[model samples]
Target chain A: MKIGYLGPKGTFTEEAAIKLKKFEKCKLLSFDSIVEVLDAVDKNKIDKGVVPIENSIEGSVGITLDLLAFEYNLCIYREIIIPINHCLITNKGVKLSDIEVICSHPHSLAQCRKFIEKLGLKIRSFQSTAAAAKFIKGKLNYAAIAPKRAAKLYNLHVIQENIQDYKNNFTRFIVVAKRDHEFTGDDKTSIVFSLEDKPGRLYEVLKEFAKRNINLTKIESRPLKLGLGRYIFFLDFEGHRKENKIVDVLDAVSKKTHFMKILGSYPISKIYESNSLKK
Target chain B: MKIGYLGPKGTFTEEAAIKLKKFEKCKLLSFDSIVEVLDAVDKNKIDKGVVPIENSIEGSVGITLDLLAFEYNLCIYREIIIPINHCLITNKGVKLSDIEVICSHPHSLAQCRKFIEKLGLKIRSFQSTAAAAKFIKGKLNYAAIAPKRAAKLYNLHVIQENIQDYKNNFTRFIVVAKRDHEFTGDDKTSIVFSLEDKPGRLYEVLKEFAKRNINLTKIESRPLKLGLGRYIFFLDFEGHRKENKIVDVLDAVSKKTHFMKILGSYPISKIYESNSLKK
Candidate 1:
């Protein structure tokens, strides 16, 4: 009945956590860092924890992926895909022309680069979006680039909405628990593996999935930490581990590589595709 | 002749530029940003510009790769690989025990996490390693985690050398020019392409290289900037583009992908592999 999220309360992760299934009866707690939230899940301190796995604009969240691959023993319970909409918020009664400076998290500022560049205002990076919103609560000339939820939470006036550089901007969040969700009939499985230092080894591994007609939703590589050119490949494919075809694909893949880990099986989010969020 | 680097001087790029072929005679000019340096090369303001393309621990530099692919018309002229060694530097006669804060660029600070955690000192992030070194010049009880070259340039004492968590750390720097180098007989080719988003499409493209006995030195994907799950693939292989077999591979690959670009060919660096850097 308890869930954890990366937060000082008003973050995208918190927004995703709020939308979890049957959240009306659950309690939510905020953790300062992603690792802390995941660690809490691993230790049973929180029933589940939510953290961002990837961004449409920024790509993968390297730290979250690294923790799941190497540091922690947890499986994804569910996924929540939401559109990342950044709005410019300021103190009440402040006109757009009155704003002399803007502030937000580095990622937010980067996401709204075009809008900020056009405004020709000095920008500063604060710790979080909500924190910035709170900092500019009583200030007339400063604005915060954050979400509409943050504006509501901080009692700020919304100056503009959806000011990000890209309209299709979205982030994929994963809920991690001690064990993965059971067969949902329609699910996605995530796995990570590394191959020997040889040519075509990756091609050989992909052949297993291709031959079985398995659709890989995502494919990425992270530095294996030994040196350059050495990577641990991460793949997300459609189908739960309980499925017969996936079992065969997993068996064939395990034999070809040196190391592999099954991160989880969870139901595909409704907003998994960028176009799905469109009206 | 003039060579440009990403710098205000006292940077790893500056060090790599100083060691560039016949560089003792070439005048060096420092640019404020990576794109500016590459833009200078593209505009013929500088003969060539040096920028970090990849790091053994951090993976690819996306901006450099993207600029070469879509924004600018430039090619790889040469590659310089050097070990990234961070040292704890302090103002003259300052002792390690007297240091209350450490400072460096965010990447450098992240690279030396274990060392910083052991010291248990407050940390600050600056614009660059050399900039941080300059900031602590006459301030007692302040130290900078920067390269040894920065220590020398800033007239600071090296309290300790090779203080990074990973000693095998190295960065790959590429020289960009208006035209790529002609065949050195032993050269490498780099290319980027985007697929049509179908199952087994990537596998089919890799088959072109595999069947032809082409050894892909590096393969990575960057977000195509359109949305998530869409990527532009980059490949580095062991032959110049003008080579017959590589030409055939490119011909075959061009048919498989919607778009492709040849980033260029240059002689492979001597320290391309981490193990080769061993004394």
Candidate 2:
């Protein structure tokens, strides 16, 4: 088996990919961007790909969601949730006062805004936190906000641990493949659909799930980009598409919606169990 | 009067602030971050603040949304929508082939991803697109993805215009103040609320508006971050809160909700009129 992920190694996406039981014996490949990973999967360059979908604090990763919605013909095969802890790391002999600028992925910088502001240092954004750590090697007057593991891998000293604004920060990642997963008893069906521009069309569509007692796990709307006030909704519900009840609800919804696409049906992630070892 | 906007000047937020009819004769202040802009408004440091809320291509600005939901007591007074156009700017006499690195705000970079990838240049993220243009001053082998105004403001040459992936890209900006606006004939009411963890609670809440023939313009759910699968929804619908029909709907929803906040009702924006001259 071959699996692709966003990396230069030591990224949160890499950590999530490693924790997957099925990928334990698979060959791991690293790509520079999420778009590349998904493109590789769509073109069969790799068997599967893992990418971050959303962060508890950062909300949706727009690139990931947009790719799945319009650009890629892929389905989510599994989900992974990992707790995020950012650290401020510098060269072994460097003191905090020596740092003139801090570097990290833009999201990491945003998450550590409070701490970064307190330090009053200039910020430079890199492609990833891990990339930021690697960039600061042998460089003077520079530090990075990255995962704690990055400090060990890059031979840097940690100035501070858990510097993110929120302690419960977590990121959700999804494994995408050409084929969708089968029912796993405990599953989530993800779909993106556009409603007709009538009053209460969304409310009417929600009734399909609500009347069937299908609980929604997530709901997000993205602009259609045709104009203002136009949107397409991405929904996650607590049932597999293969389930009879869910199929019935979808069939009814198909009649009401202008367009609908089922991204996948995959098992819901068991959080803490796979993450316990990391702590 | 004084208006606060995300700035270093030459940002989309700054443009939005300048277009406001109420702020035509008012002084405008630029802040480093959206949080700071809102904080200034909350503390009466500015009479009003303009911040980007959503983009046609990028979706919601999570930081802006999160700040309004928590840590602040402010109401949206007006909305401004402006079409976004990115330009590839470089030092005078520099050819496109001379560029070795490209810099811009992450969203600007992402919007021009195809162009940047085609050129095979290294990308550096800046706090704002305008900041990236300013950084390349007297520098060689660097190009910036910024607004066309930045090229003229910073004495750079526009190598290519409208380099973004989408031609119709637009951003929606909101003017926030200490108090809400009075009803205009045409208005939009924006609210954020949390529902009880019941299966049909969301449906029950939507019915409050739907039964009254009210139209919903937007609906987005952000994780409460208390745990997995918890969410707080931000909704925009037609009709002012002062209307009897809308007031009754709010009363019904307040009862079904665990927490509710009315961000405010304000007049819908007229697009293109203010943006026509910028083109």
Candidate maximizing lDDT: 2
The runs of at least 3 residues in candidate 1 whose Cα sits more than 4 Å from the true structure, single-residue gaps closed, are A21-24, A89-102, A115-127, A131-144, A155-158, A272-279, B21-24, B90-102, B117-123, B135-143, B155-157, B272-279
| Top candidate by DockQ | 2
Task: Itemize residue pairs with steric clashes in candidate 1.
Answer: none
Per-candidate DockQ values are 0.52, 0.67
**Residue pairs clashing, model 2:** none
The CAPRI classification for model 1 reads as medium
Give a tens-digit lDDT track for model 2, residues B28-141: 899998988999998888999999998887788888888999779899999999888788999999998899999899989988888898889999989998899999987789
Identify the runs in model 2 with alpha carbons over 4 angstroms from their true place.
A21-24, A272-279, B21-24, B273-279
What tens-digit string does per-residue lDDT give for candidate 2 at A1-279? 889999978788888888765446788899999999999999999999999998887778889988998888899999999888788999999998999999999888988888888989999999998999999998879999988778888999898888888766888999999988889899999999998889898888899999999999888888786766788889899999999999999999899999999999999987633332263
Q: TM-scores across all candidates?
A: 0.89, 0.96
Worst 10 residues of 1 chain B by lDDT: B270-279
lDDT values of the candidates? 0.83, 0.87
